[model samples]
Target: MKEGIYYDCINDFLNKNRDIETKKLLLVAEYTNFELKKLESYSGEIIGAVVPFIVYNNEFFNKGIISCDLEEENNFLLIENLKEFSIEDSFFKKSKSLVVLVDGLSSYISDFLDNLFQNIPENTQVIGGGAGKMTFERDPVIFTKNQFCKDSAIIISLNKKLNLGIQNGWEYLEGPFLTTNSEKNILKTLNFKNAFEVYKQVVEKDSGKKFTDDNFFDIAKSYPLGIIKYDKEVIVRDPIFVDSDNNMVLVGDIPQNSTINILKGKEDNLIKSSGIATKKAMEQIDLNNENYCVVVFDCISRAIFLGDRFVEELEEMKKNINPSKNLFGALTLGEIANNGDEYITFYNKTCVTGILC
Candidate 1:
């Protein structure tokens, strides 16, 4: 109904540098099979908000290159075929510094985003989120074409320098535990027994109630996965489903060879992270009086966990950011961010990762 906020950065890119129009602009939204079409539709809304601003501020870049890929389905994608159309290729070009906007769905984003630095330019930067869902099978309102069903994605790419960062406030809990057995992305065994059983052990040994099928939703909301990143930072990846066989837990992506940690989130934590992320990003540029456009990707789980607490998180952005700037994003399963040098960092269960140009 209302224009999203990301248009602020898109519009700024058009105005700041007179030469931006000469470069190629590509927009991509890498989402899961569940939200592909809906994300595409959101892209349409983004285009609607951005187009007029582009026309008004910087139409000189007569040639605008735009393409949207609903990233390949997890179980169905061929790694080789997926490699050919990389997330890096979506934005990086020779001598071109791109402005990338991303919205990740599920842990499958990691598979699609592995080896990000191989193709992206050194000057490239992005901002976006790990958006969540209304329901497993129902699509959000942004996409209405697929009977509001799940299984769709969206991506948008621009050519510019917009300071970007993703902020998630999941603190590490006990047990940087090991996976004794596994499948591809599914954990077949953690020491031994059903995956849920292993989690129950963690709860019993630690602080929480035992998880049962009737109370799966309770644990699902509070306990999430933490993947260790290159910087020794633990990235949160949400656990969506569990496979009873082989003791495997079907997470968005595998927690990898390292020990897995439990992560916890609170309303204050989400709001604080949002502020910290935005503040950290502002510090990157001329903070004193500079203007920036902000966009965000939030975990759907936070919405569920906070319920009444949710208002504070979103409200803080309005209070902290420059309101005129356009901002728009969805709740996703995972999030993608880069280390600020090269390579896209594929994270699970994190909050906002975005670019401010």
Candidate 2:
């Protein structure tokens, strides 16, 4: 794979790469300050976020583009409906190994991912994220070389080897509380009481912090809900908004009847965990004289919670991986990683690192 970064303008990147030949191209465009239409091109699919900055080749660019070239034609797949979609046998006939990148609506992430993993081959490795915003105003926009889409998703398939690592540095605060009532991504009640009331009460008690509608996100971001899995693996759900009825809306899904816990994290530990996650990912891949790029899917909530110290977290990840390796990705509303596990989970307030060679 070959990677290039352009910072002057999207036009510069598009004009220069018009003649390049490759099996597949992945574009990570940052739209923090500019509009998405400005970067629209007539070449490859673009999957990314309206993040504050972009990370490419272990460096930062406020508004830039990172493009990569792969060497296989049938290696890319773009799907709309996970359940109805089927991979052509011929696509994977040449190479069974695959890397999947997902950019979907925050509210429908869990349902999309659940159906996605069920239909894909068992050996397929996946790593991607919920591509949208925390604002909840306009739905996140995804584009494909020509048109922009909303409330939809894009799936990219690559025939490269990848090593994935997922980690959320949150510790349990309370509850094996049952999700008694819920809709897709909204928690109506927990253990027979209003979900927000239970959450607010526990957070106020644990941190001695008061909860008000105005400051709910500021206080709640440090504390997210964890869906308990086997061997104590918890899939985190970040509560983004609370309704008038105090029903909490999470970034990912919380199915009815599932047991959950409120989790807490300190800045120091969260930063440390990034390094550990990078190390864990490195352990899964063979790094012997091969060129690889590290793609990160980090939760935007972590940036809000860490404030200026978020730079330290990124630095920690760089420290763990080889200094010469390239790093690039977006700060997503939620992260996705299957890593050959029993389930492909959609997570919030976590960091997922993928070593692709």
lDDT of each: 0.46, 0.71
Per-residue accuracy of model 2 over 163-268 as CA lDDT, tens digit each: 8888889898898899999998889999999998899889999889998758989998889999987677888998877877778988777889999999999999
Locate the minimum summed-lDDT window of 10 residues in model 1.
Answer: 49-58
lDDT of 1 by residue, 318-349 (tens): 45565554444544455556655656665555
Root-mean-square deviation per candidate: 9.8, 2.8
Count clashing pairs, candidate 1. 45
Clashing pairs in 2: none
- Model 1: residues >4 Å from true position, as ranges? 1-91, 94-108, 129-132, 138-155, 192-194, 204-208, 246-251, 287-291
- Model 1 quality (TM-score): 0.66
C-alpha-based local distance difference test score of model 2? 0.71
**Local error of candidate 2 at residue 197 (angstroms):** 0.6
> Which run of 10 residues does model 2 get worst, by summed lDDT?
23-32
